[model samples]
Target chain A: MSDVSSRDRKQSWFYTDIVKEHFFHPKNFMDRDVATDEYDATGKVGSPACGDELRVWLKVDPGSERIREFRWKTFGCGSAIASTSVASVMVTENGGMTLEEARALKPMDIMNRLGGLPARKFHCSVLCDKALRDAINDFYRRAGRFDRIVVEASRVVDLVAKVTDHDIEEAVLEGAHTLEAVQQKTKVGIGNPGVLPAVEDLIRFYREKYFG
Target chain B: MATRHVYLDHAAAAPLDSRVLRSMRPFLEGAGGNPSSFHGDGKEAKDALDDARTRIASLIHARPDEILFTSGGTESDNLAVLGYARANKANGCHLVTSAFEHPAVLESVGHLEKKEGFTATYVSPGRDGIVSADDAIAAVRPDTVLVSVMLANNEIGTIQPVADIGKRLKKLREAGHTKAVLHTDACQGAGAMELDVEKLRVELLTINGGKIYGPKGIGALYAKRGVKLQPLQFGGTQERGIRPGTENVAGAVGLATALEISSEIREAENARLIALRDTLIGGLLARVPKSRLNGHATLRLPNNANLSFLDMEGEALLLYLDAAGIEASTGSACTSAALEPSHVILSLGLPYEVAHGSLRFSLGRATTEADVDYVLDTLPPLVQKLRAISPVRVDEKYYV
Candidate 1:
């Protein structure tokens, strides 16, 4: 276990050099002591007990609602830290993303930018987009427009396979008819027995509404 | 930054002792014939193997014939658990193990439960990461055939009451209540604690080379006389056909020499490590707020200093420490490939966040007072910087 890492200088067991770089020298990371009044919107996703927690704060131009600056703080592993760091930089680069555009940011987009995370650590990337959406929702929440909040459910459907409800839904929509078919596609509920009922329910709903 | 690297991850892998290397030189540079062959070179190799076995046996106070050599700690643990359990299935079909055993033991027992139809129970350790003798005894049933507990944990370094459990099991065995064999993975115990097999009362014990100051790819299982163990592999009749492969004479020699040396200086080295360990723990707890030790205060390995700095990821701390010329670990080196927090840490009733934030700094023979002082000086600011950037917050400071 311990001697495995000394083999190649280019790669560690779980992280690439780029991922390590972002983890150690993250960009657009805010000091933990930053004032609450410094940002127009803030979002938080995950909990400390879950082993990954991320908070994103945004400075948005009022008329344009364009994110001028983005800063994040993460209480998580290397992937979570690097993913959020890349997300913070991604949103603010090249004249910044609009609030809607930032809200639409996906975890894969951040993972792709960070070069990629290990298969087991792919769930860490989910924190960044969830936190970004949380920040966007926070912006809308603060402006008395609660209806504009884009609900992004980051609840894991399979902790082992790194599957989510969104992934199961995507699999169901792609014409995976049976539980086995959906499981084969997404691997959701394969290792996690507790998520089976929810996965089965989602499969039934999607199958009846779309294929019935 | 210092040019000399301070290695604090001895529990993961210790640097090989020069003496051990010297002991293996003749075997390595010579003919290196197969121990099973009948030629003169083979006889020389066979003699070397026998001598090494005798030396290793003396380290644990076991007979030479009882020690079965294997690939490493993983193989030895696997052989002890799977080999013994499968061989004695008629005695009973139940097995017991702690939840915090190395994956070698945990996974081997898990396989038995899942595929082999053997019933098993995982005894959870207490908050101090110590598996009490009573807890282990409570899990024992009339049909319980085997109970595999570690001598000392690899991650948190909590020294288990293996001998106490063994004593209780011995009573149960004598009373005809159960026919369970007591096994202890003493890989981490070799250099840090006593490995007297009779004193520990363990029927089967596992020890490895790399954890001590020896070569890698070599380990031994001490199966007490009359303890039945089936072959895990089938090939040449090496290691009494239980391990079933041509033995590495050089590796065996190195392991034996290392074990002999480690056993010889264990007490003094343990004393030195304990001082350095306590100083490191005290410094970190005093300087870093919201930090706490992971395992039992006094019952832990003298070389182990496992501490969790709240509000910071252990991987982050490890990287920063590496850049600062200090090498350490977050938890079990085996499980670090996954993002999930250490199961060993979580088994202590700690929350997942606390497990994720834990870091292990195990001292070794090469560790010096200056090294401890350097870490005491380097860690606080790094922790403060990480804490400043951390989103998670805690109010009260924690200590062991």
Candidate 2:
């Protein structure tokens, strides 16, 4: 169901000119050559046959690892596009090393930044989190600066968050295998990827009730 | 009329025809009487009710005496399944049905299990949404008392191999399983597909009148003569006492009239609506990015276009379309607010992501190419807007 934006939709082509001056258009990038500390997260959300995909493309600096740039191309609906835009820009402006620096960034944060997207479109920001991490990794990988890649608290939290039996030995081994590698080692056949919540809860239950 | 509203949910209910209205007008006014009363008006109502029963019986190829008027498909389904199973519990306590059947049949089966102590073996249709009659027959146990597979599905619109089921039931009967009553909820098949009680080889058949351009709250269950079903409720000696209360004369007349018209014009109408429906559905796929069509396309109803717009919740899509003045439904109307998606869609084994984004546009007598075109012109951009803010729009690499 392709169509208009909320108040974003112009009453007429005459109203289109007014909308453009306020919001970004279907035109060029929003400040493609932006200031330092831009968020670089890329999200490709949907499939043409089934649904949409988004890629959050954000760039974090190697040394400071602060976000430097953010941009993306979205394929699904206007809500997805708007979500990506808000996330990319907010991460760029607020991203840094301090906990408070990126504190303002979240799905709701992204939504609110764009004068709020439809509640259904909140799922669009899943890519925002991943893109932010990938961008930081990409920046470090590009600069050839780091002696070793440091998997952050933010990135590691995606199912690999806990410092458990697996993470303890794996973390000491010095990037022997990626988090995905460890997950495969620990988990059985991949069923629902999102069943991570249930898996995490199960693992926690076993640790606290039995092992602890 | 110069203008028409989109009426695609015919499986849910059809627009009452002018002719059906014409036939029922007298019954609503001058012909009002208890068909059992000893009076001229009573005799007139009785004649009308009998005539309607005969007409319905003729259309479905059943004896008029075997036909029983019901409140609608739900009641007919309940009576045929639970009624038959409970009455014959001494012989067998088990029943069987397909997982793809409408809730009218499935829920009735569930009730039989819960209340009447009847065990139901629900046979699953594979991913293609087609149930092999062989599989249904295989699920039959020695204790199976009835097999109630729907003739056609209200969702995917797949017609079951009903005739094959009937023949198998006959074979089982010959081998001494004669107590197993074969019943089908044919509510979706009345106007969209063929219906013949004998041809389908079932002991009982259920159909709804509103689904075929007749009055609402009217349906019939064809329990073949001597099928031996116990009635669920005590009633006056109406509808041969199987279904009771004052006869709904207007509803009966309307249903009979609708059945005649639908039987006569079904083929031509199917061809026309199918063309227009296909054009609309096909166009939506081409123009809308990330649009997926749900259900078996060719095997589906003439006017159904079920779609899922990924990365967007179906509820949002329905809301946006409402603002755009195009009305439609997401999955079953009964379960829409639950955010659980349609069980019909889920039974196909599609993921929750696909299920949440599902939409069904059922075509009716009034669907037109222009209406579809108008929809085509309007729907895509709404999808684009919703998709923009969606988060899970990314790629994942999987290892085999």
Candidate 3:
């Protein structure tokens, strides 16, 4: 118990020096009113209603199949801004990551580059990775490579509303802990009793995954 | 180079006044024994405690013996809501309060509902952030035992119509329609508003030292005569056995001095703060596009200026302001450990995006016009930068 408490005390500061540096002095952020033709593809993720949103503008080299420029903007916390900033650097640094490499980039990689975030802020890192994948998918869609687009693994829980497991996870990350609370946000398993058990399992899984 | 520092989160805590500190110096320097002791030193301590109680009571126009000291606003609120409800359970098990009350009162009432078999109705405030007296009174039933509301909201600083609510409740009692007692957390109002217990007609009133430029960790609850309350803590007879513990002598002294000083200078200071608050609010609205003020325009506390900028999260804005040496607060979920935005902002029927985008700048005694202008000059660029980065469009309306 003492060991855990001492470790927590050492990491009490909300942001690391790197995170602070990135948040205060972000890199490669797109300025307001950038020409639409400047970036080949743009992808956005998260919702303003959830108190976080990220938009990534990607300029990919078609011949090399590598990311040439990665600029982004976010309406989120310090951790979200810093994570996106650092992730932008990670993908575009040293001749930039290939499309495949960028797609394989995980939230852990961004967190590792950030020297780790608070347990609650782990979800913020997840947003940037998802947004980067979305940008990659957008690039592929624009290139008419429909087969190259990688869809996220999400099961539809609410058939009528098409609320997916990803929606439930996002709801949980937004502080909906209980079944009723999660239902309020996503409207999952309400009138669809057959999916109730699955929704419960997903809520438990998400609660442990992000919170623990 | 040293950055220019400007403090604007006075709603969180005010800097302790040196005069109040001087008043508490004797107690801190070991001038007397505990008030509970029977020795000569103890008698001196008791006298000092009595003096503090008298001065504090006089500030609110209550009898000296009606004042009960506790650890702080939380404890006083807990004692009033929990204590009063439990003691009068035989009378009624129902309570009424506003949806946007401080967690101290809300949690206590919640505890009663969850664990103690009590029922409660939480009346939501209007979009203007004022809890209508009619709505509050309408929620009170014959079985309602207590009603808790705040004198002034700590977030948006909208003043509640507790006096009007209290008068209606009194009328109900006179007509034998209900037996409910009125309570108001006046911690935020103690520094600015005239807190006459007679005019407010609150049976239980809570005032904290921290908000009035006094010391922290000390608060008093004014319980009208003949009001029944069960003790939250068990101990020897102290605070009439309702709040039994060793007295915080220095804290009491400091709180009394602070309240006295605040009462003396409130009118002039309020006028000055109103002008500055208006300048800050008006300047921000003019300079920053798609910004709207939160809470009532003219009915809010003189020092509070809460505004929401579109398409940007408040925590990120606060961080940029902090880097620029401007201290403020936010209603963003990211700022709190609970990951929930400000309940006060949400209680106004605003959307989550608006709540997430809210910022509060509460000025205090040492605030100057230059400080307000500094914020005016600093905040616009920061908001623009954040908005430029935000995915939410400037032309889109997040809330209807």
Best by lDDT: 3
Model 3 agreement with the true structure over B94-164: per-residue lDDT tens digits: 99999999889998999999999999999999999999999999999999999999999988999999999
Q: For candidate 2, give the lDDT of residue A78.
A: 40
- Looking at the true structure's interface, with contacts defined as alpha carbon pairs within 8 Å between chains A and B, what fraction does model 3 recover? 0.48
B32-143 in candidate 1: lDDT tens per residue?
9888899999999999999999988887888999998889999999999999998999899999999999989998998999999999989999999999899899999998
True contacts kept of 1: 0.42
lDDT of 2 by residue, B257-306 (tens): 98899899999999998898899889998997666777667877787777
DockQ list for all candidates: 0.34, 0.05, 0.33
User: What is the two-chain DockQ of model 2?
Assistant: 0.05
**Docking verdict class for candidate 3:** acceptable
Model 1's C-alpha root-mean-square deviation from the true structure amounts to: 4.4
Off by over 4 Å in 2: A1-212, B1-5, B332-337, B394-400
Task: Estimate the lDDT of model 1.
Answer: 0.81
Interface RMSD for each of the candidates: 5.9, 11.8, 8.4
